[model samples]
Target: MHLFSALAVISVTVLQAAAHGYVPLLRINGKDVPGWDISKDPYTTPQPLRVVRGTKLDSGFISDVTSPDITCSIGNQKLPPGPIQATVAAGGTVQVLWNTWPLGHFGPVLNYLAKCPSSDCSTFKGDTGAPWFKFQQDVFSNGVWASDTLARNNYTYNVRIPSNIAPGSYLLRHENLALHAASSQGGAQFYPGTFILTPVSPTTPFTELSLVCIQLTVTGGGSLNPSGLSFPGVYKATDPGILFNVYRGDAANQVIL
Candidate 1:
């Protein structure tokens, strides 16, 4: 017989009972689950699966369950020693790399965002169209993560930090990273990290600049107010989202602190 499981939109946390060969049907805000299938058997123990929650579906988020052995890192970069600097000049690319151990079978779900920490992001509210910068995924090679088939073997992300992204200390929030193979079990996890985009004087290309560490916060005035910035920043279901490697000159940079 085919078994089915469903969760309602009550103010309670959704939990699954321990069982074998059980399938899950995801329902969002009373509407049909756009890209989900119960018979497809997407649920997996010890694997990471992307799940959305909230009453009005206004709260968009990525929930991740930690894997037994999971890890992450940011590609090398040269950030300035200070907190603020000029934005990365126009026409520049940064390389961000991710290394997941024990490589699984399922690919990771990736998300990226850039926000300033201090004072609510209300200044440039509704300026979602700002050409702040651009980040692109480079590659997801399968060598570095061979030990863990679930891990991202090898990958590269190339992003160009646009020159118009007003000069300020920004937080590049990248999350929702799931490994393959672990998709059906219980290893869908959030690979969240922050990158500092310091806009410095474009006098000369500063290579190997030191990066300063800072906390990330986006209160958005109150609970009802949404952080006024393009969210989840950049998203990718299979490959890395944003690359943070800095080559030279003025450009956005990222580091794990």
Candidate 2:
């Protein structure tokens, strides 16, 4: 009887842990940045908006691209600005760390950045209205994205910041689409993510005061595509990026845009 009780407890614990997955930590240039930590209830933090969790859409609005929940899932509330900010230079890399990832949930990993109206991005609210640009996206390579690579190996994903992005404060959004069960409509699992503050500045070349003016902007002349698509607007129910069959092993045909 005791053994059966222990087994039941173990099952419940596992289920509870797998109930949700989120990026609890973020790193820039190999150093940890101030971000959400799901281990401590994110709701209690100053940046509650940075704690939105994923939803199980096996039977619900998984295929509904027009739904507001499609942006970051339902029940996700916006909070006041966070006290911390991630300072990054254009053309640098940022690493995202997930708390836990379930096995077999394979699909693409996408990143977007939305410039804030003012210098303080922490004051931004809601998932819509803010036009976001697709700065970084990884599609099916070798029949899989970061899902299999991150789940089986490392839980951290390194993404490069756009080299052409103008210096400003913006909100960085990341997502993981689990398509293991996406063979049919509404079978896909959407893990919409929390938004973090990203303040971009030019990378200084030298510490000398005389060189400061010359390095006021990113060295490279590259420019980010100004045209952007809204989250709910960027995706459609029939769009190839949204609806795909990963199990068929035809990753080369997968849609990335």
lDDT of each candidate versus the true structure: 0.22, 0.46
Regions of candidate 1 where Cα sits further than 4 Å from its true position: 1-87, 97-111, 117-156, 182-257
Index of the highest-TM-score prediction = 2
Mind giving the per-residue lDDT tens digits that candidate 1 earns over 4-48? Answer: 000010001111101100112222223322211222322334222
Model 2 regions lying over 4 Å from their true place: 1-20, 43-64, 73-77, 126-130, 186-225
| Model 1 deviation from native, Cα RMSD in Å | 21.4
What are the clash counts of all predictions, listed in order? 62, 0
After TM-score superposition, the amount by which residue 73's alpha carbon in candidate 2 deviates from its true location, in angstroms, is 4.4
